[model samples]
Target: MALLLTANVAGRTNGRNVARLLQNQFPAGPRAFRVPGVDSLNHARGQPVSWLVTRTASISGQELFNNYGLKPNSELILGYGFSLPHNPDDTIVLKVGGIEGRWEIGRDAQGADGLWKVILSKFVEASDATYEDILDASGMLQEMLESLIEKLPEEDIAGNIEVRADVVEMFHHYLEGMSNLVAEKPPEARSQVKMPFFALW
Candidate 1:
């Protein structure tokens, strides 16, 4: 909050003793928090902190000012500790040959769901490998996704649930994306990418 209000209090001194007034309002704390200045880490929560906050309150939490409004469910849950039941910013990324292709799955904005034949054509166009090779590697990937999904139970497997249900939902979305990729991509040379995150085979 203080971070957002600093600019409002900067030049709008209004002829009053703004510095002293702000100091009285906020005094000091454990110096646990930081306020950005010309230098990133030079300022602390001492003077004008609450003044900054109060001034920005009028604009704070307003959608126009919150850049996080478009973040996907996965990022919000893991980074910000919050998520909507249905976020339209969600995406599924397909990492192939060290290249990543993001497949949007948002309600208002997603891909046209590529045709299997078109996808396979693209694969053939991009690489020199045979159709059989692509299928074998893709089969490996699909099985990997299926196995991970299967390992996670609908209900908690034991007294302790290690993964959140929402996280599982994101994975399901990823699996859906993979299913699309596998369905369309043509056979190719053996994949050189290691499967640590996606496999042991």
Candidate 2:
């Protein structure tokens, strides 16, 4: 008989780290937690990926935003705009197709019976000034998340059990690498970028 040993490693905890960075920027509220495996990390090179989240209030809960408007089957469409690189010598205007996202309410938003929805846009910038482009991405992402948080009440997620451990573990596996974070091209590559935060409002 032959015996085989296998190793199973868990995700890392950078949730606390990134959450601290977010907290430093805003006033106190529900803590920020990050998780990886929620979305696929190995995406096609050069393509941007958007992670759909129904409710920051409840991960397992339905979406809170969806309940206000639209029926259970209704849909919300969010726009995502991106700017790609073009030479100064070129006279033609540049416009890339935006990525569309949807938001829906489920058991997590309210209760099993209640429903909610979210509609958000995702954008990307691929100009010669890539660093600035990422900053723009961060700003856009932060703006959207902040707006969503403000639309909801703190009570929705207040004191609810936080998925801090899940966040920390996921961050370690997916978001903690320089190679993964930045564009490789020079001039645009030197700039620093930050991940957007979703805090309790």
- In TM-score terms, which candidate is top? 1
| Candidate 1 whole-model C-alpha lDDT, 0 to 1 | 0.41
List the candidates' TM-scores in order. Answer: 0.33, 0.21
Q: What is the lDDT for 63 in model 2?
A: 23
Query: For each candidate, what is the lDDT?
Result: 0.41, 0.28
Worst 10 residues of 2 by lDDT: 112-121
lDDT per residue (tens digit) for residues 1-201 in model 2 = 111111223765444444454566545644443343332222222332222222233444432221222212111111111111221111111122353333221211221111001111133323233545555554554454345435433323336567565444433332222111121111211124333322211
By lDDT, who's the top model here?
Answer: 1
After superposition of all CA atoms, the RMSD between model 1 and the true structure is: 13.4
lDDT of 2 at 153: 31
